[model samples]
Target: MRVVSLVPSLTEAVAVTAPGLLVAATDWCSHPSDLDVVRVRGTKNPDVPAIVALAPDLVIANEEENREGDLAALRDAGLDVLVTEVRTLEQAFAELERVLVDGCGLARPGWLAEAEAAWRDVRAPSERRTAIVPVWRRPWMVLGRDTFAGDLLARLGVENAYAGHADRYPRIPLEELSAAGADLAVLPDEPYRFTVDDGPEAFPELPSALVSGRHLTWYGPSLAEAPAVLGAALRAARG
Candidate 1:
């Protein structure tokens, strides 16, 4: 079956599970770097006409990464679109299985089981650390309540400072975030690419954990390694 994926993580999941199944994917679908597929466009502003021209049997999208109108347009053009909602790790696994096994009619990849086992074995720290996770730098948008990243951190025994906030990704001033009295600042390398010299300086008083955004924020084969990878990074930052 010919598939066009808009979500990067979904694209990686499908592509890695069954090579050559994808006819087209967004430019942001960077995994399996040697992927030889037609580039539709970015997640937010995909080229509708270019995608329709591909004549894919299924178009995979994420409710969070993609716009509703874009999915509607694809449907209006008579293209079958599968939209996946992944708010937590469980949701990510379930939605991935639905998209790959049920929707695409492919055999469940062995890696999926490994990923489940990895997460299942993770034990949250006895004493949790309050973390201020910044996804973006300019205007400073942070991970708030009910985010997948927040859930991942929670599993690692790191509670988000703004988890009680109403907005999922809220923009707050740096001073306000520092004043929130977080024990550590969990910084990822995407959306803003926070590094040792960059994000650490903002919070001199708190420890900074520089983590892989793909592993922390992305839900895919990376989930299998995220538990180990994220735990080490968070621990190292504390020391």
Candidate 2:
């Protein structure tokens, strides 16, 4: 079955699920960097005409990952679309499996199973609560509760400083953030691109760690190494 993946996470999925069936993909879909990737018109406002030209049997999209208008356009174009979202670990696994089986009819293999096993084995000390702010320095947003960012930290036995903040990606008040009283703050590499030199006042004096935004945020065979990699990084910050 020919597949076109709009979601970047699923780009990796196609690499693992079906060895050679992917026909087109978005620019944001950058894993296994050897495939013939297509030009991205935009993440949400994708080049509809180009995608239609591919004439894929299926398109893997996400409700949150894509713009509603693009989804509507795809529907109008009479193309089959499979939408997926990752709010929790279970939902994450389910969505990926659905993409694999429904889109390619392939079974979840070794790497995926290993990734799940590693996640379940996590058990960090409760005393060292982590304040994982996926630092987007510009416009400065903090990842609050009910988000994949918060969920990833939780698996490492760390608690979110904004665990109860109802919003998914909320604009944080500088004063409130100063008072959040977190032990460690993890700065992720993308969507905001925080670096150590950005320094203290905005970043503060607490223990800091630099993490991969894609690994923590991206879900696929890449997830296999994230739990262990993140666990080690989080643990080092606590110490």
Candidate 3:
């Protein structure tokens, strides 16, 4: 079955599970770098006409990464679109199954089970650390309540400082975030590209853990590595 994926994580998921199934994907879908699919543009502004031209049997998208209008446009064009909602690790696993098994009519991939097992093996560190995770820098938005990344960190004994905030990604003042009483600040490399030089300086008082955004925020085969990848980064930040 031919598929067009708009979400980066979902694109990687489908690509890894079933090779050559994807006919096209967004420019942001950077995993499996050898992926020779047609580029359909970015997630926020995908080329609708170009995607329709691909004649895909299924289009995979995420509710968080894609715009409703784009999905509606595809549906209006008589295309079957599968939209996934993943706010936590469990949701990601279940949704990946639904998108692959139910939506794509493919058997469950073995990697999915491995990814689940990897996360299941995670045991929270005895000493928990209060963390403030910043996703962006210019306006300074943070991981707030009910975010998948927040839940992942919580499992590893890193509590998100803004987990109780109303907004899932809230824009807080830089000064406020710096003084939020977090023992550490976790910075991811995407959506904002936080580097050791760029992000760590903002919170000099707090130890900074510069992490891989894909591992920290994305769900897919990466989920299997996220626990160890993020754990090591978070652990090193304390040292």
Candidate 4:
């Protein structure tokens, strides 16, 4: 079955589960680094005509990552589109199953089960610390309200300070973020590549956890090791 994946996390899931199923994927689908699929540009600005021309049996997308107009355009051209919405860890697992087993018609991948098992084994810390999780800078956008990354961090015992904010990804002033009363800064290296010299300096008062964006954001095989990987990073940063 030829499939086109617009979401990077889903791309990795499909690539790792059923190697030859993907005919095209977004330029941002970086995992499985040797992935040699047709690059369909970015998630927001995919080449719709090119994707349609490929004549894929199914095109996988995410509600948050992909544009609705693009999905509608593909459907208008008589292509089947499967759009996923992942807000929590459970939602991620369910959506992955939907994309792989239900949409791609493949057997349930072992990694999916392992990822679930791994998360289930996670034990929350006795004392949870609040954090200001920043996704971007310049304008300063942060994780707020319902978010996959926030849920993941919450599971890891680092609560998002702006989790009660109305906006999912709210743009707050740098001064406000620094004064958000968070114990630490959880910075991921994607959407905005936050580095040691780049992101940490912004919040001098808070401990900065330079975590892998893949482990913190992407919901695929990386989920299997995310708890361990992220837990270690948080520990190192806090200690």
The lDDT values for all models are 0.92, 0.77, 0.92, 0.93
The digit string of per-residue lDDT tens for model 3 on 1-239 reads 99999999999999998977999999999998888899999999999999998899999998989999999999999899999998988999999999999988889999999999999999989999999898987788999999999989999999999999999999999989978999998999988998898655788888889899999899999999999999999989974
Tell me each candidate's TM-score: 0.98, 0.93, 0.98, 0.98
Q: Write the per-residue lDDT of candidate 1 for residues 1-239, one digit (tens) a residue.
A: 89999999989898899977999988888898999999988999999999999899999999889999999999999999999988899999999899999989999999999999999999998989999999998889999888999999999999999999999999999999989988999999986899998655899888899999999988888899999999999999873
**Shift in Å, residue 239, candidate 4:** 6.2
Which parts of model 1 have CA positions greater than 4 angstroms off?
Answer: none
Which of 2 and 3 is ahead in TM-score? 3
Clashing pairs in 4: none
Candidate 1 TM-score, true structure as reference: 0.98
**Clash pairs of candidate 1?**
none
Better of 2 and 4 by lDDT: 4
Clashing pairs in 2: 200-204
Off by over 4 Å in 3: none
Q: In lDDT terms, how accurate is model 3?
A: 0.92
